[model samples]
Target chain A: MRPGHEEIKDKLPEYISTGNIPDDVKEHLRSCDKCSQEAFLLQELNKVQVPEPGGLFFETLPQKVRASVRQKKKGFLFRFVPVFTLIALVVVTGYIYHTITPPLTEEELFTDPFAIQVFDLSGLSEDDIPPISVDIADDEIYLTEETSLYREFASLSSEEMEDLYEALEIKNRNGGVL
Target chain B: MDVKQTRYAEDLRLIEKYLGGDEYAVEELVMKYQRKVYSLAYRMTGDIEDSKDVTQKTFLQVFANIRGFRKKSSFYTWLYRIAMNTCLNHLKKKGNDTLELNESIAGSNGNALPALIKEERSSFIRGSLKKLPDRQKTAVTLRAYEELSLKETAEVMKCSEGAVKAHYHNGMKRLKEILSASADSPGRKGEGI
Candidate 1:
């Protein structure tokens, strides 16, 4: 009676490792010529050793192979440096943009356009005018009585007032006002 | 001192030096393992020239990627993995069936059997190994020749232990059949089992 094929194949490594063949398996191996031959072949094959590539092997290797190898290694890093540098450059540019550029506020945006509005005297009448002498100091601005005739100049629109203010050298004391 | 012990100590020291940025350490490493790496390459590719190329490429890869090595595996095992990968890639590029038996085995003189056969049964075993499939060949070579444990072989081969076992068993079985048949060929006399 032959041992099953799967059983024999599975147990073969165990047998080879331990050299402990079971009684029935051994009997079956002996009787079944194919299995017996396979066993013999396995035993013979085990005797084979792996051959060394032999000494003096490295002597035959390419001369200064290490130099070429190191060069190739450097080549790999060199290839990636440009890409890494580009990435770093982009990141730094982004950081600088974020840090140096001030954030725009809603108040600044709205107030900047209306800056001239502060100089408007639209609701003031002649009676509402305080004596110019009271507000103007002589050292800052000489408000001569003759210049008081120009006080009604406030009735002009801002564009017209800007034109007249630039025409006179009188240092339009309140020219900056809207 | 035992050769393996002396070599192992030297290798460890060189690896330490290499990690420390000693450029010469790479050369020392190449010198130490070049033969083993070349032999593995030859076995995997069955071409002496290709094996040399593979060995060189393997060392290059090892040195280039050394920083990534976590020391979880032995240096030789790591080197073997590189050599195997290099050879496999070469084989794949060249097509697996393009494996020429005569390339590695042939010498200046006609099929140099005497030189190859003198190494007891090892040459015969190596010859038989060439007949197995590529994966089986790799598994058997690592397991039997490299003397790696089943687990280590599996790790190197990137397969399960059961898969390694299957490749190993099938490889051994094929080698047995081939060796037996070759031994019994017409020109050869029936030899001792």
Candidate 2:
């Protein structure tokens, strides 16, 4: 047996159809009845004609297929319309809500936690405001002590007056004796 | 790969489109293979209307089962396999269940006639071919009549390349025997294969 006969026999059908036999396969096919017989039959099969249909027989197939698909989609679209409408309604409602709603005021946005709203004083004149009172006597705080302290202490309580009288008496006595 | 080879890639792209719900892709798919499918059918069934029927069945199968097609082979290969099955079913339904040979005589290579005689010869060959085993007939029809490559024939036949070749070999051998036996004499009732 030739070294390549097995391969050739294995590939004989392809070799016969394509006429591109390997050299070893070719050598083997000459002596091999089985392989040669295959080659001959394959060759004859080549003579069979591929028949062509007359006119435009196949031209309408695309339309037919398209029509069928269209029918299916139309059925689907009936189901599709309600879902599509629902989605559209939701989206439109969301957009309206975002557009029509009022915005937050600056005060409401940036309010201070420690601050309170008070009446304005920038519009008031001095005469429109009351004076602030000081608890000190005028002579002491404004008169430079030239005024008599005895007159100011005349309304003092008994103990304080007594102490003031004593201090005054001591001062007078020390002045006269000295 | 040759010019015809590039069409496979294009077919894959269209199939992707078809799967993606482009109706146009369906139309395009039908447009691409309709004629070839019809022609293969016409040749296989030997009737124009029957060819149309099988072609319709073939594409219908493509439409229905396209989602399940794994892209393991090119779309045409799978389509033709479906076409081949449909054709075989048709032939089977028509009860051409065996190779009942009808002998047809011929003029040898030197004396073969032209025109009308050629048509006669072609018809005779087709007629005689029906007598082959179903598998051999399918292999030859795909490989020879359709001129599909062995690989494509294997895909269409849903068999290995080796198996396809074996079917082709047996078919070719049987075809030769039948043709030769018929060619032994013209205008005579031939023996059954």
Candidate 3:
């Protein structure tokens, strides 16, 4: 409870072990009953004898430790192998599923069944439909010639147009025979 | 580097080698620190067999967790920390079934009498030490017996130096009281140091 007894008490363990206290602290310890008692008890505690293991114990300990750890390592694998296998199985299953099953496109998702029935009735498979190319050049819509039956019709001469109209008239009169 | 730092560096190298699959490094490391770890474990448990178990567990734990041992603290301090934890856990689970003093003390080769006396003194001291709380017991063990510096003790105990001082001081007072009480009791006086 003196001005420096607290400090001396803090250093008492070191002092007890090695007698490394400063002279002033030693003086404080000498004068302070509580600090001196603490020092004594710590010194006594420091004298406690732990039984030493025999020479063979030290000599064989590393081997024992390594063997135990190796055993545990095997046990660790034993415990986790199933979990790892399950994880790998799940991953492989997921990869196969993704590899074989393509994702649906927007057109596939929203295709009309009625339109498909109409195409079936027309006896025209989807592959029979010409692919259309639209150009928006010069602020005007232009359908490519390959995709445009209207462009072919417009390119026909007047005599060929008359012949085609007469043939379509005769087929119409015969109830859509053409 | 100083001797301590040099040892730390050597310990780190051995640890790296062990981690790199060199089994001989394990032997080297265990050979290097087994005695120190055993001594601490003995003090903590107050029984030789328990100390051995604790020492084995400590090394196993150190090897098991060695990869996580960032070189932030000295390898010695980290080892002490693991050893201390292993000792505490061993005592916690085993409940400190210290051997009987008569059965525990082994006779030395040359002089039986001084050896017996020293063993008896040690037994009394360990009994008193067992009476202290865990933290206090650890503080006293590390600071007083192990001869670690206060800073090193704090690092091992994973507390500040101030807390180490407080725990050690309180432990000393409590130890003195225990010794005094034991000394005052009949038939226990001559056995004490």
Please, what is the TM-score per model? 0.52, 0.57, 0.63
Q: Docking quality tier of candidate 1? A: incorrect
Give the count of colliding residue pairs in each prediction.
Answer: 3, 3, 0
True contacts kept of 3: 0.65
Write model 2 residue lDDT over B58-146, tens digit each, in one string: 87778778889897888888888999889989888988656544433222331222222233456666666666777887887777656
* Cα lDDT for residue B154, candidate 1: 74
On TM-score, who's better, 2 or 3? 3
Over B127-182, each residue of candidate 1 has an lDDT whose tens digit, in order, gives 56665778888877776556566777777887788998889776755655454444
- Give the distance in Å from residue A167's predicted Cα in candidate 1 to where it truly belongs: 28
Docking class of 3: acceptable
Q: What residue runs in model 3 are displaced by over 4 Å at the alpha carbon?
A: A1-8, A19-29, A73-178, B96-120, B191-193
Q: What is the lDDT of residue B83 in candidate 1?
A: 81
The candidate maximizing TM-score is 3
| lDDT of each residue in A28-78, candidate 2, tens digit only | 777877666556555555665666665666677788877876786688679
TM-score of chain A of each: 0.34, 0.36, 0.42
Q: Candidate 2: where are CA atoms >4 Å away?
A: A1-44, A72-178, B1-5, B97-120, B185-193
Ten-residue region with minimum lDDT total, candidate 3 chain A: A112-121
Give a tens-digit lDDT track for model 3, residues B1-193.
8878899989999988878877778888999999889988888887788888888889999888988999999988999999999888888797755332331122212122222333346677777677677888899899887768889999999999999988987766565554554444457755743
Which ten-residue region of model 1 chain A has the weakest summed lDDT?
Answer: A44-53
- Model 1 residue B60 CA deviation in Å: 1.2
